[model samples]
Target: MSAAAHPREREIAADLRLRAARPPVARLSRKVLLVGTATACVAIAGAVAYAMAARPGAASRPELYAVGGPPPERLAALPADYAAAPKLGPPLPGDLGKPILAAGAPAPTMGAAPSASPEQQRLVQEGEAARTSRLFANEAELRADPSPSNVGGEPVVGQGARAVLDGPVDRRTVSPDRLSAPASPYLLQAGSVIPAALVSGIRSDLPGQVLGQVTQDVFDSVTGRFLLIPQGSKLIGLYDSQIANGQRRVLLAWTRLILPNGKSLVLEKLPAGDAAGYAGLEDQVDRHWGALFGAATLSTILGVGAELGAGYRDSAILRALRLGTSDTFNQVGQQAVGRALSIPPTLTIRPGMPVRVLVAKDLVLEPYSG
Candidate 1:
């Protein structure tokens, strides 16, 4: 029992010593680490300096080029006595070359006057005297008073004198070439109106025949009792479909007139009018604002899409493809916009719209008996 207790006591003592003893921790000092880092940096700097100092200097700059020699002479190294070939045409009879060569020579200085012959001197003196006499004569004429007979109360004017107005003048007066005598006693003269109403609708989409019915009685210009065009007469006409931008009127003309009794007359291209006597009919005008706005919006969208991500760098092929696509989109957008702009405004005149037949010329017709 003493031996077993002695072994247990030794074991307990060893465990106590192990628990009291602390293991050593490996910790690097901040000063030592800083010192080692500085040393390494200094060595690296020294190596860099040595490398720089050992490298050879750059090559010397090349000297500037000397000025070029003078150009070669034009006539140097040419054959001596190189005369021109003989001329193919004969010369003129007179010595015309002398005057031409003399013209090219240096002109004489004006320091001294040329010697003049006696006749020339006489001519010059006579001319001076005549000029002086003329000057004196003009002065006298200007100073002389007019005769009492010529100085009348009214001023005298030449027969060619005429009045003129010089401002921006236009032909305000026209000849009466359009005026004409009445064709017949039973005639509807110019400035006359035959009231009517549209029998068919007018759409500017396509050109087609239009129909109308006279709504009022038209009479001859000579007699008030004569009835030329009665009410309910059919008017066969055509309306123009060529619409322009912002245009709201539809031009139409009557070509033939048919009475209720079946009697027809072939009328010329007589123009249509409104109640106010204005040419063409007006009702509805469609400028297609929605279509225009849509086109503009589409163009803007295409432009924005084309310009997206344009700042980013890309490969040559990609860049080229992007530019091509951008240009294609841009062109398509522009074409779409242009096509929208080119669309003309639509003019519509609904049925039952009041219209008039303006008589541009004389119309001879038999009085309606029915």
Candidate 2:
């Protein structure tokens, strides 16, 4: 017998017959699907191709690359202007090249113009001459003693120039050796003192007299190391008398100090006034007065009290006698007080007393040889 037709086979045949009998819609659908799939694949491939082309190492845009990249083998040569120098305007005017000057401006000078006046110029010339002269003199002195035993013997240009230019040696720059054996006048400081002794006796009433002789050397006030006045210098003064509190006091007014170098200088009074022995006499009198007054007052009080007590109990005659005794004691007390308060005589200054005097002004003295 023939195999019975399978159910699946029958269904397959039916589906094939239905598909064959239908319109071309299924084939069209398949074609549409295939076209869509092909379109999507084409779009994906275009995107990938674009990404690879846009990568970092990819070439720039065609226009920029063509201009910036190396020239092509057939490139044309550049124009002549590329190698030519730039054109410039005409040169500045000759007058414009010079510096402009304002009206009334002084003419240009080769160098700084002389600013010194005639007198100043003369002085400068004189100073220059003096400096040159001193320089030559110093050179000569140096040559004369190329190996001089004493280097100090060389004359200093500055010192000599100062002497010539200023008309006198500058005492400030004077060497100690030169000052020690001074041949020029030297100024002494203020407040310097010379010990002196009275040459003759002088009383408070005396007016003018020679005072004394300097017995000791004196030094300069500025440079206390330098000797200013030597021994045996003369001192002259006036005995100035004044009346104070009805007492005459005398002061030795120094007038002149004759230095041993034969130079005379006005002298001032010593800074320390008269010695203690000459002061305070009036104070002593006042003390005496105070003591006497105190004693007298006490005595008077005691005498009056005693008289009153005696008179109260005594008869008239005895009372009178007691009063008289009291009066006598009171009178004695008054007399003692008056005597104590009396002004004493003025102090008298005698000559031959040692004294010190100061230089009135700056004194220029030469060194004494004796």
Candidate number of the best TM-score: 1
* lDDT (10s digit) by residue, model 1, range 1-370: 9998999999889888846667899999999999999999999999999877844666866769644666458655454554753445555336664554444455566776789999999998896565444222343454364234344566557422422332235666977578656778899888788899999999999999999999989889887679999999999999899888878899999999999999998779899999888899999998888888898899889888978857666888888888998899889888988988999998889999999998888888988888
Best by lDDT: 1
Error of 2 at 242 (Å): 2.3
lDDT of 2 by residue, 1-370 (tens): 2345677787778887844566655445788899999999999999999877847876866564355667655554444465565666555345632232222245356687669799999997886565444222355566555553447787765775654674534668655663354333456655455567777665433355645887888765555666777889888776643434555444556777787667787666433123333421121112345666686787778677756667356798887877788788787777766765563433444455666665445667655565
lDDT of each: 0.82, 0.60
Which ten contiguous residues of candidate 2 have the minimum total lDDT?
278-287
* Model 1 C-alpha lDDT versus the unseen true structure: 0.82
Q: List RMSD in Å for every model shown.
A: 23.1, 41.3
Question: How close is every model to the real structure, measured as TM-score?
Answer: 0.51, 0.30
Model 1 off-target regions past 4 Å?
1-183, 309-313
